[model samples]
Target: MTAGNTGRKRPTISDVARRAGVTKGAVSRALNSGTGVSTGTRERIRLAAVELGWSPSYAARALNGKPLGTIGLVVRRSPEILDFDAFFPSFLSGIESVLSGEEHATVIRFVPDAQTEAATYERLFGDRFVDGFLVTDLRVDDERPAMLHRLGAPAVVVGAPEGSSDLPTITNDAEEAIRGLVRRFADAGHRRIAHVQGDRHMLHALQRRRHWEQAMGEFGLEPGPVEHGGYTIVGGAQATERILARSGDERPTAVFYGSDLMAIGGYSVLGEAGLAIPADVAVAGFDDIPLASFASPPMTTVRSKHRALGSAGARILLDMLKGQAPPLSTVLTGELCIRDSSGDPV
Candidate 1:
């Protein structure tokens, strides 16, 4: 039988050079298209490599202090049992993109809330689990940053960690972003504004709440309507019911929802009430989701820089691991993309 039929191990660069009648350095110059190698020799080396099924030794390259190349993406949220991809695609796409420059890959995991979050690192700190961690969705009084710091693990927090001294953090200015919505509605002559906030325990919701209240008072507007959404579309819709049942004078003329998912709920409930948008009550939300512009008249809302946030966090973590002094916290501004939900500018 011919040798081609046998399951032989692949040849090496040396074998390719030998077959091509060139020195190893000449073969490398040919493969790299360096200036020295003649055109005919380059082609012969390439043919030899192909025939032998030769490949570069990435493991050898990694053995000399060069990273094997992977960044760990750690999410504190619980992993949903469903197979369907949820809100992770956007952020994951972002994380994947930023690491492309360094040829690094992300290993994503969703821990079971705070208790397990603290426990996993305890076991995995030196177990070769990851090069570094990307901590997302930081909560108020979070313990993960301190835990990572104590373990001397490099990490980048997607949201500001609680009581952190120097862990690199990348976060969107949630309060300021939402405050603009409050200001815009008040300036647009809608005084009775309502906010459908998300989970209070989370840092994001807390930031939104603090800003919503402050911005309303800044323009001399009375305390606007407020309700806890628990970050659900259904929860938001039910919260809307409570606002709708209030007295006529107390009824909100405007509403700001925490997320586009919640906005979907608020829009549905408001439509059922026969309330004409802006004519009866205006609505807005955050996280200008892909479907936001498609919602009936579109939506006037704040758009989180989720992709940038994830990308930036990953970059910071890598830098920290490299012994670079990256920013302790990186804050990015968001946009108030005006859509039909808030009505015309007037």
Candidate 2:
């Protein structure tokens, strides 16, 4: 029953086509450029190939100068962060939803730092290991866009628009969401509001900080103290402790964390300090991860379409590989989910 049995030959494209009830050319189009074949037929062909354990030969692809039918994702984060970070898992699931049906594989490379990250991208593209890339975690001075452009690599950025590069982007409306969250706090008569931000280097973190400041000004309220939580639970707890060290009037009436995990961290600190939720200090966070709703007092946070962002970014990259021009910029909107943590909806 296995391909490793004696006298058993390897499955071929012809075999895959026969199993899928499609022509050889249809199989080729579906697996290679994704053109000419309908979506349903393409999925059928891919499923047949899976059942038959048929895979294209990389050696043959290289010899023929054909695409490798693989997409690359280079993540410059620690493995520990990836394990607990809710955003990445959901995003990856969205990417898999599209790539699995199209018979394209994803090549994920985790690097420790920027130098190795750049080198990995170059090597993957130069060696023909990937047909395109999906870039994430945009930084302040991100060089991946320009580097990939120079390599003539097809890539789509899943972050904010980078003015330095002209790469296609699939971004969430995080700024508006953060501003709205701030307004909600202000509307609830919280004059002293504090912010717990993530890494300053990340564009999203910077944007959230800036939007919080701007929104506070718009409401004629001086922005409260800001602390760097590093987007971690422990970091959030430590940051909250520092904020609480201030005198009663000097302390913030409410706090907005950059991520749900951090807000959860702040919860422990708030409880230990004998403060009541939304009574002593209200709390809100971004990225409404599953745990957000299950918290002791359901968290009020921003619900970013993380999965949609991944799916859209992958689809755009696929279109680019197929010589199609997708929209240069796609922005998805997020909703502010108000819950008990931030008090009754006003």
Candidate 3:
């Protein structure tokens, strides 16, 4: 006869310590920064915490006049973008991977415009809701690094190097990957290679476009028609339609999109136009997301380490919070994934 269990109280750090056969101080050191704890003991404490379903309370920390064990991430994008844009999900998962081990929480906020975005940051830091921030989507003439500095808020930028700011950055260098993609197309005898880029306001989008143009010039090929896709599937489709509007010899034989979502959208437009992928026109994209592999003919794209970028950025932020100086910049490499969509994966 088993009793029905209900109204059970939440587990605490004490329970975790008891379960792991360690003292509460050991639990604190293990979860906070592993300062005075051994690796084996830390792992044992973490497993105990997980088993006990115990996580530190940010509210409790705040009440105790301690730094909130919280990390802030404010994304300046429509909420709908989070649904289809694969980068955010993977990046966030990476951040969680590190933060969870440290018993920290992430505060995510979405804003529709720059004004609202800036205000959100101010409010979050000003109110002590978060100890630090993880900034993303580096823009042209970005003001976030300087703004955060003024507020004396610790932060780590998760994108390309910002010449105007000295904040630590975790970036994925995709220039060579983009160039390699272009070279692959050229080697496959593609002369007119077009590109569908994201918003020019974003540094990443601008960088991708630049890489494509430079790679085209390097191959002694005239760059094909270029269009802005806004990093959306619908935008990709519309851009593809415009690209196809060109006359016979001017039309591109291969198209490289700045994102997999755009390339997937381009797929639909190509299908409706009765064009066979890799048979009539080759296709490629950046960010080799899960769907890229499942794409009808599969997609050839650049695999940027979005998860690694997030995890690395989180680590740097944690180090900053601990009064440690992290490197000014950390760059991860991107890989060009060859798939069937790009002319027999050559």
Best by TM-score: 2
Deviation in Å, model 3, residue 310 alpha carbon: 1.5
Per-residue CA lDDT of model 2 for 165-251, tens digit only, reads: 578888888777778888888888898999999988899898888888999999899999999999899999999999999996899
Off by over 4 Å in 1: 1-68, 81-87, 162-164
Show the colliding residue pairs in model 3: none
Ranking of predictions according to lDDT:
3, 2, 1
Q: What is the lDDT of residue 139 in candidate 3?
A: 93
lDDT (CA) per prediction: 0.76, 0.89, 0.90
Root-mean-square deviation (CA) per prediction = 5.6, 2.9, 3.9
Q: Residues 14-133, candidate 1, lDDT per residue (tens digit)?
A: 899899998998986775434598888888888898888786564653554444456676666556522222246777777888777555777766786667767776655455556678
Question: On residues 1-346, what C-alpha lDDT tens digit does candidate 3 reach at each position?
Answer: 3477676878999999999999999998888767899999999999998898897887887787667889999999887877898699999999999998777889999899999999999999888899999999989989998899898899998887447466888888888988888888888889999999998799999988988999999989998989999999999999999999998899999999999999999999999999999889999999999999999898999998989988999999998998899898898999999998888533
**204 in model 3: Cα distance from truth in Å?**
0.7
Global local distance difference test of model 1: 0.76
Show model 3 residue runs off by greater than 4 Å: 1-57, 63-65, 344-346
Candidate 2: clashing pairs of residues: none
- TM-score, structure 2 vs. true: 0.91
